[model samples]
Target chain A: MIKAFIALVRRDLLLAFRHRAEWFNPLLFFGMIVTLFPLGVSPEASVLRVMAPGVIWIAVLLAGLFSLDSMFRSDFDDGALEQMVLSPYPLPLLVLAKVLAHWLVSGLPMLLMAPLLALLMTMPQDGIAMLEWTLLVGTPLLSLTGSIGVALTVGLRRGGVLLTLIVLPLYIPVLIFSTNAVSAAVAGLPMGGQLDFLLALLVLALTLAPFATAQALRISLS
Target chain B: MWNAIWVFFHKWASPRYFYRLSGAVIPWLWALTLLLLLGGLYLGLFVAPPDYQQGQSYRIIFVHVPSAWMSLFIYTFMAVLSGIYLIWNIKLADVMVRSSAMLGASFTFLALATGSLWGKPMWGAWWVWDARLTSELILLFLYLGYLALVNAIEDTRTAARAGGVLILVGVVNIPIIHYSVEWWNTLHQGATVTKLDKPSIHVSMLIPLLLMAGAFQLYYFSLVLMRARVELLEREWRSEWVREMMGRGSDG
Candidate 1:
């Protein structure tokens, strides 16, 4: 099972790298969204400082949304997903492997780029660490939860808009907690509670989402 | 008793039997709904004394509270129906699930609209990012998501089963979402007074609230059953019972 998991993850990662443009799409999109906030909202440091946490998290969210299609779209198109479903190994394990690879390609780039974007937003120095921490915990949750949505819509012809409507609601709590934690840190307040909440939600998404995704994949593919 | 219960469920599972049973039960439900709505409206709007704090505008609670409650109640009801459909693969359960989503979305919309109307007079703003209000809005989105998913899929049974998975996911997340929003609200707002946190209301106000709640429950059942029957007929149109019913000229 472990070997299958690694092999699936490696295969996905290799596929992601070979495409090159698709993996870079989310990072470029994330950068563009973060940059737009200053022009659309304001360039004032004080205003941006207050809005920084929410702005960054929302950008991360939209970027995650942008990349979700790549998680299962290729494999599903080429019939690799059907093969995975019929393999001797459990489907949830394989689904989790795909989600992990997705997070590494899409979610990790956003996490790495967030601090630079934070500085661009004039976010306070003290909050950067907390922002990174929240992303570290929150982004995986996004990937795991989002896989369920992607799997459900994998078979649809025009699933992009419908996918956003379905999955964005599920991401609200993560956005709330992560932004709250960063804002608290910026204000020199204790952010432990919000971080803890994010961690709890991550744990939840980690355990339940893979099975739900596998089930949804079956339903969609059927 | 166990054997009888099992037999009852088995009979109820049949689409034709369910069509007849709901046909018989809906008139009573509609009658009860009418009675309760009239009584509750009279009591809630007129006989109930004015609040010391907000006077006449507080009467909106009669409509607002019940609609909000029904919104949550119907989502939960959908989740349970979805669970049954997923576990037993019962066709009727899936029909009910399909029938319930639109009603749930309407109630959620009603809740948000009424709550906003009430807020404008009371809070001096049409909307506030209060925890209850935000969570209700998110609940509305969840309902819309379910509807969108059901519409997007071409195959009916597959759409329903996929919708079941979405509902189960939403149900599990609702509490956590509510709590996180509440905590976030408090962190920013420093404990504002919650609008509906009535610990000790007088009997006069409480009576109409409960009456309205009962009225909403009956109305929901009546409508859901009516919709369920229509859905059942549409899905089972090729079945012999449906053809016979059509030939019988819509005898309810």
Candidate 2:
């Protein structure tokens, strides 16, 4: 079972790796959104520094959302999902594998790119580290929770906007903790508390969200 | 005793039985609701002494508190019904969920509207991004989203299953909404009734609040049963029992 799970994860990673443009669109989109923030706000470094955490967090969130719709879409289209459901391996593990691949492709790249964006926004050095660290813990929660949304909407004819409407509110708690963590880090306050809170949220989402996502897939397949 | 309870539950699980049973109970339920609402409103508006600080405008709690309580109560009820539907795969539970969604949305709307009305008098504004208020607003959005999801899907079974899943997912937000004020520094006031040891409100105030809460419960039941009957008809239109029901209605 473990072998099958690793194989599925590896296969999804290879598929994501082969489609290089699919991987880059979210990065480019993230860069473009970060640039737009400087244009929309004043060009002053102080102002950008004040808004940096919020701006960077929102950009990463949008990039994560953009990549989410494709999580199960391609598999559903080509009958791969049906085969997976029928396979000897458990469906929930398959879902977890796909979510891991999604994080690797979409979430990790955005986290790695945060420092560069932080420099663009004139964020303090500690703030950049906090942003990267929070994303490291928080974005996986987003990916897992978001897979539930993606699975729920996969069978719909046009689910893009509806998916956003359904999922964005769920993202609010994560947004609050992640941005607050960065803010705490920037102010040189004790951030251990907020980081622990984010980790708690991540743990909670990791435990419950996959079951819900797997159930949603069953409903869609039916 | 177990057999008897099972029989009772199973009987209600039949839509026809539920429709007939609800028809018998709804008139009494409506009458109770009307009596309690009128009595509660009169006492709350005029008889109950005004607050030492906020004055007569605090009377808005007559409507607002009941609506807030109803919103939370109904969502918990809906979640339980969704759980039943998931476990039993009973079509009746699905119909109950469809019926409850509209009523839940109505109560959520009442909570928001009356909250705004109260806010204008107290906070000198119609809206504030207070934590409790924002969470309640999100609750309204969740309701609307659930309704839209169910209506968008054409297949009845698919709609029920999908809507059920959405409700289950959205249930996570309810606790967050309830505790938002306590967890965060916000403009909204803290709890008056939900405290563990003692409720903060005076007995005179608490009495009318309890009465109005009872009225809201009956109001929800009367409306949900009425709507569930209609939902049953639409879902079972092709069944023999529905044909017989239609024929009997025509003959009468």
Which prediction has the highest DockQ against the true structure? 1
- What stretches of model 2 exceed 4 Å from their correct place? B176-182
Model 1 has a DockQ score of 0.91
What TM-score fits each model? 0.96, 0.96
Looking at model 2 chain B, which ten-residue stretch has the lowest summed lDDT? B176-185
Interface RMSD of each: 0.6, 1.8
Q: Alpha carbon lDDT of residue A102, candidate 1?
A: 93
Each model's lDDT: 0.91, 0.86
Clashing pairs in 2: none
lDDT of 1 at A93: 98
What fraction of native interface contacts does model 2 preserve? 0.49
Model 1 TM? 0.96
